[model samples]
Target: MRAIRITEDHAIDVIEARVPALKQGEILVRPRACGICGTDLHILHHGFPGTCYPVTPGHEFSGHVVAVGQGTKGVREGDFVAVDPNVVCGECRWCRAGRPNLCLHLSPIGVGRAGAAAEYVAVPARNAFAVNEKIGAGVAALIEPLACAIHAVETAGRLRDRRVLVLGGGTMGMLIALASRKMGAGEITLADPVATKRAIATRIGIDKAVDPSALGDELFDVVFEAAGAVPALKQALTCVDKTGTLVQVGVHDVDVTVPINPFNVYEQEITIVGSNSLADKFAAATELMPDLQKEAETLIGEPFNIWDFAAAVESMAAGHAIKTQLVFD
Candidate 1:
């Protein structure tokens, strides 16, 4: 088997490796399509929390079940599935409370275990949700990110009839805006510096897409910062209406800090919240994908072969596509 490996010294290689042995309740999947995410970039260049060195870096993926381990239920050989990468310790307090994203021992597949940037990857059968084959592998691979977007919107509470603003026009931002619209947001505004991104957002049913500088004197009931950039976060903070909520959906450096007005937060009754990973929304995202198939399809760009992992990373870093993926031959 061929697997893309990222070492601790920031080296990437597509090396011949042994197929992963499935444990009890695990299934071995032959990944057909995998999406490279920002987290993969972090794991490659610097490092991301919980990343295991020499790891295979692909979390957003869908594949066929080639083999099922003993005791595995609900999944079978030849079943097409999209996987939930977050592997939690079900005995943890957060897990027991149904907030597995915050589990004390959360070890996501790509970050902490071997992931799907290979010919075959092993995952707990419970993490694999059967998806319609008609959706195609590219869109099925999007289910993971869509689940995260759903969790982000879920963190925002009520959105029906609320004015919503999403910062950024990347895959996560686009999905967040789409999710907001699905949740009955009265109006959706997406701000991105790139004209191409704004165009894509507009084409995908965003109510309004404009340059960040063009947004003047307008505030939103629910503001989402999904760009994972400090500048976008700063902009999102100011776009929230009084008594409204601001959802932080972006990943930031551990040491990074941005200035905020304590007075405004207190006097205006602003609620600030942080949304982590998908939580328990993977199944819901799988259920929602068929309805969102066309829209999701528009976000995907031409895919690179799984062996061209470096090129895919470079393309993603260059902002060449809204969603960059790898396809198995």
Candidate 2:
């Protein structure tokens, strides 16, 4: 099989590797499409921790089941499925408490195990969810990120009849806005510095799209900061209503200071929530596939076949595209 292996820290090589044999409770999938994310970019620039590189780096992907492991039921061979990359330990305190995102062993499939950046991948059968025939392979690739968006909006609580202000216009940010609207937010505004991104947001149902510098005076009941960068997150606190909820969906590797003047948090009575990845919400997202697929088919940008993996990385780093995908032919 043709595979792109991360041979060492900050190094990648495309090689002809022997196909892996699946063990019990796993399934082998022929990779159709996979998307590049900010996390992948982080791994690409800064090598892995403990000097260990990912075996294969693509996590956000979708494929058809070519074979199934023994003891796996319901998911059979030839089922079209989307992969849930999270690999959680069931005995963790957080898992017992029903929040697996905070699990002690939350290493993901692409991070801890080999991933879909190759001609084929083997994943735990339980992590695979069936995708309907109506959903194209490109759109199915979006399920991974949309699941995160779904979980973020779920943490934000009811979107119907509420005012929302979303910060950032990247793939995550855009999907956050789409998910909020799908969940029935009455009024929503998307703010970003990119004119092109803002335009894209408005076309996809955000009530208004504005630059952060030119934000309006309207108060919001919920402010979603999908931009983890300092300025955007810092500005998020100021944009919501006095007693509003603020959900920080974005993540930054470095320390981010939130200077809370005692009076502001106390007097304002604001609620702050930090969101991570999906948990049981993977099932919920699977249920929401109809709407998610509708939005993804239209909102997802172009797909790229990996003729040259290095060029794909270079183009992604250059910001020449939105939602860059690498397909295994």
Candidate 3:
């Protein structure tokens, strides 16, 4: 089997390894579509915390089942499925509270366990959701990130008739915009410095897409900081209307901070929230995938084969790609 591995030296390379073994209640899948996420970059360049070295690093993936383990049910060999990489302990207080995203013993497949950037990946059968042929492989690969966007949308709450501002035009930002539009947000605006990204946003029916500098004094009912940059977070704060909500869905450096006026928050009754990874939104995202798939094509870059992982990363780092996906042979 061939897989992309992140070694202890923080280098990414295509390596040949034995296909992972499946345990009871798990299934072996041959990944057909895998997304190159920001987290993957973080892992490759900065040694993302909690990631074990020599791990295959792709979480956003979908494939067809090749082998099924004993005791697994509801999925069979040849079934096409999207995998939820988050593996919760199911015993933690947070898990008991229905907040598995915050489970104390969180072990996501790509981040902690072995992931799907390979010819074959073994995951618990329960983590895989069978999808209809109507969902394309590229679209099915988006189920993971879509779940995160869905969670962020749920955190934004009641977008009906409300103006929404998304402070990024990357894949995640676009997903947030798509979900917000579906949820009935009025006059959706996307802000990014990248001209390509902004153009794509407009082409996809977002009301407006502009450089951050052009974001005038007009305030929005909800502001989403999806750029994952400190400056973008600061800018997002200023775009929120007096009583509007600000949702931070982007992953930021742990040391990054932005100054906020305590008085302004108190006086305006403003609400600020942070959304992490998806909890149980996978099903909802899957259900919504067919509707979102058409517009999603504009957000993806030219697909690369798994062997060209380095080129994919370079494209993303050079800001020429919105989202890069690797296709299996």
Candidate 4:
């Protein structure tokens, strides 16, 4: 089997490795497509929290089940499915509270354990969600991130008839905008520095997709900060209407900070919330796929084979691709 691993030295290399044997209640999946996320880049350059070294890094993936270990049920051989990478500790306080996304001991595939950036991956059978033929593996792979976006919107309280501004035009930003629109947001605006991303947002039916420099003084009922940069966060705070909600959906560096006036928050009663990874929204994301499929398809770039992992990373970093993915050729 061929696999891409990030060494302890943070160097990515391809290696010939023995196929992993399935454990009890696991499924052996031949990954059909795996999207490269920003976290993967963070892991490659230096480190990402909870990522053990020499890990195979791919979380957003869909594949065909080739075999199921004993006791596995609901999934079968040859079933096309998307894998939810987060494996939560069932006994954790957060899990017991029905907020497993914040499980104290969460192990995510591609981060804390071996992932699907290989010819085959052994995922717990329960993590696999079977998809119908109408959804290709490429688009189905987006279910994970879309689930995150759904969770973020849920954190935002309500979007119905609200003015929403997504402060980024990247893939996640676009997905957030799409989700907001579907939730009955009165108007959706996307702000991005990149023209290509803004254009893509416009193509996806956003009411407005504008350059950050050109974003006027219009206030929004809800602001979604998806860029994960301090500047974007600062701007998102300013874009929110009085007593509006600001949802931070992007992952940021631990050292990053933004300055804001304490009195402003007190005076406006602006609600600031943060959304982590997906919770129980994975199934909702899957159910919403028919509405999101067209735009989701547009967001993925040309697929590369697993061996071309470096190229995929380069494309994403260069901003030449939206959702660069690895696929079994």
Candidate 5:
């Protein structure tokens, strides 16, 4: 089988590797669709919890079950399923407490475990969710990233009738906007420096996608930092209303001090939260996949093949692509 591997030299090389023997509770999936993600970008650039060298690196994916494990009975031989990449350690305190996203030893399928970039990959049966035939296979692949956004919005909580502000117009910010609207936000605004991204947001029913400088003075009941920039984070703080919630969905570009003033905290008493990877939000996304697919397609600008991974990564790194996905099928 063929798989794309990121070696210690920070190079992406595709090669043939024997598939791992399926475990007792796992199944072999011929990955039909896999998307490039920000997490993959981070690993490609800065080497993360990523293995030392020569590792397969795709996580957001969906596919057909080619073979089932010994203990798996419900999933049929040819079921189309969406795989939850966050393989959590169920025994950890966080997992025991139902917050497995914070699992200390989380070796997500793409990073610590093998990924779905190959012709065939093994995934735990428990991690695969059945999808309706009504949902296209290509769209099934988007469930993972959409699930991350679902979790972020759910964590923000209660979008009903509030003034919502989104700090980025990238994929995550668009998801946040849709979720916020679905949950009944009274007024929603998206701010991004990229004119192209802002244009996409506007095309997708976001009336207020604009530069922060041009957005004028306005406080928000909730603010989300989706650009993953320190400046955006600072601006998000400034835009939140007194005692409103702020969710940080963007991966930071660089570390910086989070300014805190007792006066602001006491006077406004705001609640700031970090929205990390979805806590099994895939379940919700599975339910929303049909609608989300139509929406994600409009937001996602293009598809790139494995051979073009480097160029796609370069475009995304340079902030050229809004949502980029890989075509492995």
Candidate 6:
């Protein structure tokens, strides 16, 4: 099998490797499509928390079941599925409390375990949710990020009839904005510096898309900082209306800090929240994919062959697409 591996020294290479062996409750999947996300970049260059170097970097993926191990009852070989990458210790307090994203022992695939960046990868069958093949592999692969976006919106509480602003026009931002619309946001504004991104947002049904500078003094009932950039976070904080909620949906540097006005937070009753990984929304995302399939398809760019992982990474870094993916031949 051919697999793309990133070393501790930040080296990436596609090398021939043995196919993964399935554990008793695991299933071996031949990945059809895998989306390269910001987490993959973190694992490749800087360091993301829980990343175990010398890892195969792809978590947002959909694949066909090639082998189902003993005790893996719900899924069967030959089924198409979208996987939830976060592997949690179900015995942990957070997990017991239904907040598995915060589990004490969370080892996500592509970060802490071998991921779907190869000819084959094995994951717990429970992580695999059956998806309609008609959605196409690229759209199925988006389920993971869509789940995260759902969780972010879920963190924002009520959105019906609320003015919403999403910072960024990347895949996460766009998905977050779309999810906000589904939740019945009265109006949705997506802000991105890139003109193309703004156009894409407009095409995808966002009420308004504009340059960050043009956001002016407008305030939103709910603000989501999905750009994962410090400047975007700062801008998001400023755009939240009094008594409104601000959801931090971006993955910022662990050591990064931004200035905030304590007086404003107190006097204006601003509620700031941090949304982590998908939590338990992966299944919900798969269920909702059919309705969103068309719009989700538009976000996927041309895929690079599995071996061209480096080129895909470069393209993603260059901001060449809303979503960059790797496809299996």
> Which TM-score value belongs to model 1?
0.99
lDDT, candidate 4, 1-329, per-residue tens: 98999976778898888888988889999999999988898888868889988999899999999999998999999999999999887898899999989999999999999999999999999889988858788899999999999999889997899999999877789899999888889888899999898888888888999988787788999999999988899888887889899999988987788888778888989999999989878889888987788899999888888889998898889988668888888
Model 5 — which ten-residue stretch has the worst lDDT?
A: 46-55
Encode model 6's per-residue lDDT on 233-270: one tens digit a residue. Answer: 99888889999999998999889999999999998899
Which ranges of candidate 4 are over 4 A from the true structure?
none
RMSD of each: 0.7, 2.0, 1.1, 1.0, 1.8, 0.7
Q: Candidate 3 on 63-102: residue-level lDDT in tens?
A: 9999999999999999999999998889989999999899
Candidate lDDT values, in order = 0.93, 0.79, 0.89, 0.89, 0.81, 0.93
TM match of model 2 to true structure: 0.93
lDDT per residue (tens digit) for residues 1-329 in model 1: 99999998988899999999889999999999999988998888778989888898899999999999999998989999999999999998899999999999998998899999999999999999999899999999999999999999999999999999999899999999998888898899999999999999988889999999998879899999998899998888888899999999888876789999999889889999999999999998999889889889999999999999999999999999999999998
Query: Candidate 1: where are CA atoms >4 Å away?
Result: none
For candidate 4, the TM-score is 0.98
How well does candidate 6 match the true structure in TM-score terms? Answer: 0.99
Model 4: colliding residue pairs: none
Worst 10 residues of 6 by lDDT: 44-53
Number of colliding residue pairs in each model: 0, 0, 0, 0, 0, 0
Candidate 1, run of 10 with poorest lDDT: 247-256
Superposed by TM-score, candidate 4 places the C-alpha of residue 216 at a distance from the truth, in angstroms, of 2.9
Report the Cα lDDT for residue 281, model 1: 99
TM-score of each: 0.99, 0.93, 0.98, 0.98, 0.94, 0.99
Stretches of candidate 5 off by over 4 Å are 50-52, 253-255
lDDT of 1: 0.93
